[model samples]
Target chain A: MAIVTPGKRPGERVANSKVLGKRFTRAKKVGHASLMLTSLVDMFSIIVIFLLMNFSANGEILYMTKDIKLPSAQHGGQLERAPVISVSADSVTFDGKQIATTEDLQKGDVLNVPELEDVLREERRRYEQIHVNDPEHPFKGLVNVQADRKIPFKVIKRVMFSCNQSGFGNISFAALAKTAGEGKPLAAN
Target chain B: MAGAAAQPAGKGGKKALDAELNLVPFIDLLSCCIAFLLITAVWTQIAGLQVASSGGPPDQQQKLENTIDVKLMLTDKGYALTMAGANIDIPKISRDGAQNFDRKTLSEKLKTLKASLPEQGSITVQPEDAVAYEDLVNAVDTCMGEQLRNVTVAPMN
Candidate 1:
């Protein structure tokens, strides 16, 4: 058996004295701003899930520029740590160093780039000396080329020619990774 | 950061009991996680398409002999696939005269070529001076998707 007593609810309750009533009345609307954490938590959780999906452990990703917009590809391998040669409409740079100008390369009929070859040769030598005995990370002769999508193939041909000349025979073109099913499926015979 | 709420216990109740898991620390941790992931997230996955020789030291690439030289040539007009002294032209089909070569036809031709030469997995891409880099990349991508992994880019003479 329980005994019930008549009590004042929150709405029906009155302040004890004049000062208390004034204080309560003033604090009611001032401190009543409650945060809607449900929606905030929901949005943060969604963003966290999306970011986790796109997170990559490969820290040394390509240092891309606004000038070079890479082409998208469906089939490709993960980028290896190699010397990158970025070619834009204005100039050709290797490992952030300006090796040659695009206009000069286009004007000249020579396929081989002497300046770029020198730099790559030095890099290849250094790599060989460092990894001579270590079989784990042998010299793979890999190099990355980041070029603009709209640039002419003539500039790329020279860059590749120079890369091959400098013993970096394995040339990998940096491309934006695209989903597989975005394009129509073509049979691989 | 945890406490049980006092509620009337009943065998049959009008409202279903719902436990509100409102933790300030949990929200704080979630915010931290979201910040960390957002800061370190790689929005666009930049990958690599290997399109050249395994030859190293002196640059004298081995001539791919005893194999049909499957060369896909990209020109200003269209794409021309050359194999063993024969040229199969696959014209670009676009209303605005853009470089839109028929990928399906090219795939069929490559399938036929691959069936004939199963051992040869390498291809040489020859691009003209006026050809765009994106077009060349797309051509190489198609070849690689068709299991021709070893693609060597060469300047068209």
Candidate 2:
């Protein structure tokens, strides 16, 4: 037999039980309000791993200035960490310091550049000093050249000649890597 | 945690260790690491082509003299391939309206030269004043493609 209160009808008793059951279920759901941190952490882990792989594969990074635009080459190898000489259409800089203008560098038919030679000689001396203490770190006389694509080969030759004269015999030309099937010819300016 | 500590020991007398993990600081550290890695990532790859400017070791020079001296001169008209004693000229032929050296012919010629003189590893590339830098690099690329690694750029007067 259903026990009913004196003021309530039998139907009202059933309705009350149903309402209490719904409230119990709603109260049980309130405990499940947890943040899905595991999925977020999983996503971040993938991104971190991907970025780390790229960082490792990328060898020495060359910080290029705004004045130079390196030409694209299909056969360039990894760049070594060395002194950088940047040549643009208007000016030339060594280690980010402006040393001479394009006109001044190509002033005469003379192959030697005096100002660049002086700067490179100082660099060689500094390297030699560093190598005096550490025999393992001998001076390799390597230099990196970052020239604008529009610059003529004559100016490049002059710069290269100057580098040779300054005792930096090993020269490396900086270029952007070109992927296969790009089909776009390199800009000729 | 205080309420649990105040409770009478059930079963064994040992206190239960707190197992809740603090994720706020851990998430903060991960965020910082991700941001740093993203900021330091290198997008474009920079590469180099090595060339020796002048004098090398005596032994290396002796080895060089044993083989032919290949000189590739970039002229406005075409590429002049001079092999110390042999004279071979490849004129600039236009393909698709752009004046360019005949790369195929040059490559074939270089392959023949490489076959004849296997010890020759260097080639001197001299471009005229009017020649573009890209053209010079392209010529170098062709030379390198044919197994001539030691590419030296000569000064143009």
Candidate 3:
């Protein structure tokens, strides 16, 4: 059914015709969807800021293994790149290769570990050979030692001795930097 | 939001000045940044405690030998601060299985040593064979905290 109504003003019929034409044109674009991305953008922006704040420019070289747990330290400095000697609960490793067994190091009464010394000497020679010409960056004998907190000091003493005997005297002990929220580890351990 | 240049009326008014800002590409860029940052994030800081091994290469010697040599011995009991022909012992706190007596006695001894002898900057830590490795680290850390930076790890004499 259709009802006819007369226009009250002179231009009312023209405006009505123009509105009907626009409505007909808008009907063809109804399939397109506009997603409300305001909330998603807000969430992603926050995530980006949080991640950027925690990003580290210099990457860590030491591969933390499941067998070793480093002790936390309230005062620790930046770790310069050097040869790493990892002493876990069961074995001692140089870089990624196994050097000696824990039992052998524990039982031996000598001040220095013979196997560790040999490896360290070879490493020192390699470093010296590579830097033979460059006088500015001579071998500093710096080495980083990563050891489990529960290992006995006897093993550490021998390792230290071996490092010293092989000219790797500038030893640095690798540890986790302590934060404020974490409770102190057993002080006597 | 346009106020100064007003529209005449509704029928024949000026064109709308509002423009749409497309957020699809912006969100895409944010997503990529978040992924990259998360991949390179460092959860825990791995640091190092430096201790130049004494008796190293013989060239490190020939420093001032007259300064007081502070020797800290770490055993199962606690810390033993020995220097200048005097020994002060710090035993474990009673019944506190995990509490260290560092704050009680050793702190005072170390403070007095620091105040009395401002010149001594190094301390040799001698840990017995049975002592746990963490205790040695803690001992060295305590010494460093007390302004003794040049720490050395040596076996018990």
Q: For model 1, what is the error of residue B39's alpha carbon versus the real structure, in angstroms, after optimal superposition?
A: 1.2
Q: What lDDT score is found at residue A151 in candidate 3?
A: 91
lDDT of 3 by residue, B1-157 (tens): 3224533344556666654565666777898898788888888898788887767765653456556888989877878888989898888665355645463366568778889778768888888898876767777766777788888877886
The DockQ of predicted model 1 stands at 0.43
A64 Cα displacement, candidate 1 (Å)? 1.7
* TM-score of model number 1: 0.77
**Tens digits of per-residue lDDT for model 2 on A1-189?**
888456433454554696554443323346467789989888888888888888845445565768777767777788888989888888888888888899776566777778888999999999998789898888777999888877887778778888877878888888887764454653321
- Between which residue pairs do clashes occur in model 1? none
Off by over 4 Å in 2: A1-35, A56-61, A182-189, B1-29, B55-66
User: Listing every candidate in turn, what is its Cα RMSD in Å to the true structure after a full C-alpha superposition?
Assistant: 9.5, 9.0, 10.0
The top-ranked prediction according to DockQ is 3
lDDT of each: 0.80, 0.77, 0.79
Please give the ranking of all candidate structures by DockQ, highest first, separated by commas.
3, 1, 2
- Per-candidate TM-scores read 0.77, 0.76, 0.80
Q: Candidates' DockQ values? A: 0.43, 0.38, 0.45
State the lDDT of candidate 3 residue by residue for A1-189, as single tens digits. Answer: 577565333355554686554443333557688776888888898898888888878777687899998887767788888999999999999998899988788996888888889999999999999999999999998999999988998888888989999999989988888754576543333
Superposed Cα deviation of residue A179, candidate 3 (Å): 3.3
